[model samples]
Target: MCGKRWILDNKTLLREYIKKYRYFSLNNVVQSIGIKRCVAIKYLQLFKSEKIVFSAGRGFYTSEGREFIYPKISRVIKIRQLIIKEFPNLDFIIWNTLYFQPYYHHQQTHNITVVEVEYDGIQSVVEIISRFYRNVITESKRKLCTSEFDITNDPIIVRPFIRRSPRDGNEPRLEKMLVDIYIINYKYKIMADVDFWELWRSLFSLYRIDFSKLIDYAVGRRNMRVLISQLIDNAGLKEVIFDSKYDLLSNMTRKKGGRCRDGKTRHKTVGIIEKRNTI
Candidate 1:
């Protein structure tokens, strides 16, 4: 076969082979197609560019090629601009809850901008932001429940940054946002268990979330075990990251019945995570 015709024919065959497995490794493709490892990797890259396949971590490729859509950051950038103009050297991260509206079942009615600045600059950052924004809170989530303060009114929360929080440029990434929201809800009861699980389910089904990155952020926040238990029991994400180092947690979960002592029943939303079909 000529080189061009051979490439075209092999590409068609590869697509057909890929359709048989929801998730497959490079070895699976090489052995099944009787191709070299280098050739299989080349083909996988072509498939990725064509939106026919996507990396699912741990050397696995998934045929479901749903791309992660970045939230609109125009408003976030405006806030960042205001902060940067004041303290050009300040190291900080800024994000808003309004970015998560599409991932929730019931639309979130309120918008809260969170500004996490370095320890040395947090007080000054808060002072600068307070001059422009009326509904600004500094370092106290306890005040969120006060009758005097209305959370529904868009609030700007200025807090000190923790070392090693995940970021995309000057804004928090999806991984960081997931961990923070989960921990906040765990501590404050801002949303019911059922509602929280539903939001996670919707997000997992629609977006390409980095499970490992999310876990790392949760670990930094000292909520790794709590978050992983919720992921396996409540969100039914065990199978999604089964190949990860968290595989041992699956056994622990079964032995413990994966129940939290809070007395509120956690409903497991399953089948949203893509299954691994035999190659």
Candidate 2:
């Protein structure tokens, strides 16, 4: 699609249009610019390279530099296809460490594929996956942290699905993946003493994270402490906290174990937490 062609004569008009609209889709650009979809896409890629336009999500663009890096779902698609071939009705989410490669410092040589299934179907899914793949561990916390289960060897960890996990279809949303990585690092030291704050900073700087959804999922996993710490340390993130609808950080600081104002634990669902206090 990015093949060499006549230089975009409409680049200035495209920039002005995006600046005025703030948020737009590919079709919107095509209609407004009166250009072929492929031609517009090629120009858009050029604009993105020049840091003139940013990806808000799939087929979505913004003038603001906050680019939303969508996870590459080819592997997830293949795994889902395989799982669906046998258990056509099973509920699961498939994600891998490779999605995070864009935000991290070093190019990761090792990858971990995480397959999360509902309680009853965990074993079945693991069994099905084990047939095609090696080093499959089923809900084994010890195995994840042990030397015997080398993560560098490309291991597959099957976990029980969290209720109401934030997702983009069958794969985790960026928010859910961020929370999961923090919790995984806390529990199993999976990232191996890597600087998490920097990791999160890179992620937040690159993607359009839904703070409310991220916090909600973190609370569900009982892993808000790490997030809270990162926010406290970074003044810019604290500003984001105030800007976001998720003002529960103050209340969270007062209450332990992710309790709400009514003294009940936070719900598993995202974007449902009511605002109580400001931080």
**Cα TM-score per model:** 0.67, 0.62
Per-residue lDDT tens digits of candidate 1, residues 1-279?
598898887788789988876556666677778877887889989989988888765455777656455677665777799888988988898888777777777776766677888878877887877777777777643334334345567777777787778777786767788787776566445566787789887877666665545654565565666577667788866545444534433222222223457974432211111121110
lDDT tens digits, residue span 143-219, model 2: 44355457677888888888879897777888888777776666556565455556777776655655556666676
Off by over 4 Å in 1: 1-46, 49-51, 58-60, 70-75, 140-150, 242-245, 248-279
Instruction: Name the runs in model 2 displaced over 4 angstroms.
Output: 1-67, 71-75, 140-148, 192-194, 234-236, 242-279
The TM-score leader among the candidates is 1
In candidate 2, where is summed lDDT lowest over 10 consecutive residues? 270-279
How much does each candidate deviate from the true structure in C-alpha RMSD? 10.1, 11.4
Query: Whole-model lDDT, candidate 2?
Result: 0.67
